[model samples]
Target: MEIKEVAYDHPDAVELSDQVQAEYRTRFGYDDTTPLRPSYFDPPRGLYLVAYENGAPVASGGWRAQDAEDEGYAYGDAEVKRMYVTPGARGQGLARRILAVLETSAREAGRIRMGLETGEALPEALALYTSSGYTPTTGFGVYRDNADSLFLAKPL
Candidate 1:
């Protein structure tokens, strides 16, 4: 597996984003509608990372700077987004690898915490974060007040 940093609109990255949304539609009954700008993932503020297996993108995730009061944000809250691993790549730790990369990159970029909003349907994602030190928190972001939403935070 190769972990590579890329622009959010990079061809491969865009492809994976679509794939993630497709899965999300099936799992959550709707696709995420939040606006995502490529610049949001640029360094000095945040980053986007993709993991490739045999040259095929398998997993991806990114974080962007957010004020403490902003949705999906808390202390050091660089809001995590688009975290996903392809079905064929499950159980290989690719999701965790991408997550660690996001956390480390965000910390190096001067962030002190990480936060995210996920839906209840994504047990795998919640499990990954919980086992990696993320603790339950209140909901924010597009899913705020949504009964099926789950929020988590971690100190970087």
Candidate 2:
């Protein structure tokens, strides 16, 4: 598989992101009323990475520098976001590959740590984060009071 930088507007990237959001809603019973906005990807502080195999996008992930209000739990850090691997690509370590790329990018950006929030229902994701050296962290970002959310962080 090959990893590449992707713009939010990339066709495959946009489609895969939509699929991911749908999966999140299906798996965790989240309302589809509030979509993850496109503007989240535009910035001086965000990085989006996509992984491809056989000329098709299979996985993607990104990180953004934490905002001032996020300092309580994510100071001097970047927040991992939008991690997803297509169903056909599951169990192939594609997610891990995407994560490695994102982590490297964050380190290159001078970030000392990385944090993320995943739903408790995603056992595979929880396992992946734990095996990748991330540890449980206090709530962060817009998910501070979300009961189904599990936060994790790793020092870069």
TM-score of every model versus the real structure: 0.94, 0.88
Q: Write the per-residue lDDT of candidate 1 for residues 107-126, one digit (tens) a residue.
A: 88888888888876998998
Candidate 2: segments with Cα more than 4 A from true spot: 31-44, 70-73
- What C-alpha lDDT does candidate 1 achieve relative to the native structure? 0.88
| Candidate 1: stretches off by over 4 Å | 68-72
Score candidate 1 by TM-score against the native: 0.94
Candidate 2 accuracy as lDDT: 0.80
Residue lDDT tens for model 2, 35-154: 344455544466787888899998888887775554355456888887899889899998998888788878887778889988778899999999999998888666768888888999
